[model samples]
Target: MFSTALQSLSSHLPGCASSGGTSLKANLKHITVTLATWDAVWEVYLDPKWARQQLRLYGAQDRAMEQFFKKLKKEISELSMKRHGRAKQRVLFVGAAGIGTRGDWGGDAVLWACCK
Candidate 1:
């Protein structure tokens, strides 16, 4: 039960943005579904206001970003059913971090050369 997440990552992945415009938000539905298949995944957003507005996760309409992600951790740890016949270790830790994705190259590495 997998689906392409093109729409869901509009906020996090920066695909739907055009010409200095904002992108659509679908992180909640996507992350929730993906969590069903994953024990843990890292989501690090530097901007709280932007991330909250973008990650329209279930029950997050009335909660702050901290509350939202804490609930997510809870769901992943206590709720989701593993899709296998055996037990698996699960753990996740979220923290503050920054990355520069505005250009094709940065951070001691060259990801791509969009312009030659």
Candidate 2:
């Protein structure tokens, strides 16, 4: 199911060209998945576009990121049922004002160094 959602994202957002001569479609690292045991974890990568149009600094618009959130919820709910009870859960939908190519990191205090 998660794979299906990832596939759909590529369709929704046509990629932009990057300096490395690769398109954003080729850099699907935007979405990250990690595994944990005896606990529930669902991390949905928020599209940069969605954040810009629908999200505010201190709040979110109704259904701002609904589609992805719903899919993650459904998957987590199903997995929780198999354990027969509520579990320690961590659901993260992450985005930034401008982390990728949208803007240079100019406002934040955190120095973000990277590898070439």
Candidate 3:
């Protein structure tokens, strides 16, 4: 079984990415996390908030950025496992934007990345 967690960022952002991390821990805490995933791929939602935080640095077609996001999320999951001292096989990092609401290139990019 997979223990997935999904957390959305508050629409209330403060000063771009500066205070963006302010709500990170709180948001993460709400992700329904239990035992963290240790060896499985980390599938994180591509929220505009998160995408803007790091994804914006790469070009639209930059493949490296995709892997970068994957590695970053995986590391984060590892940290989560360390904190909990347990490991699962899967987890979900859902962003603020949910299904049928993605209306931007970032949305499409995530789909492509995930599906590919």
Judging by TM-score against the true structure, name the best candidate. Answer: 3
Lowest lDDT 10-mer window, candidate 2? 107-116
Using TM-score as the yardstick, the better of models 1 and 2 is 2
State the lDDT of candidate 3 residue by residue for 40-78, as single tens digits: 323343445766756554554456746766775677669
Question: What's the TM for model 2?
Answer: 0.25
lDDT per residue, candidate 1, 8-112, as tens digits? 444465565563543233545656678775643333344576567655752353245445555655565454455554434454433322353542224232111
For model 1, state the Cα shift of residue 96 in Å: 9.6
RMSD of each: 22.6, 22.6, 22.8
Q: 1-116 in candidate 2: lDDT tens per residue?
A: 76677667657766652236755444444443223321342222355765665446313422333444566666777788778676435444344434433333322311221100
Order of the predicted models by TM-score, top scorer first: 3, 2, 1
Q: Name the regions of candidate 2 deviating beyond 4 angstroms.
A: 1-64, 93-116
Local lDDT at 88 for model 1:
45
Number of the top-ranking candidate, with lDDT as the measure: 3
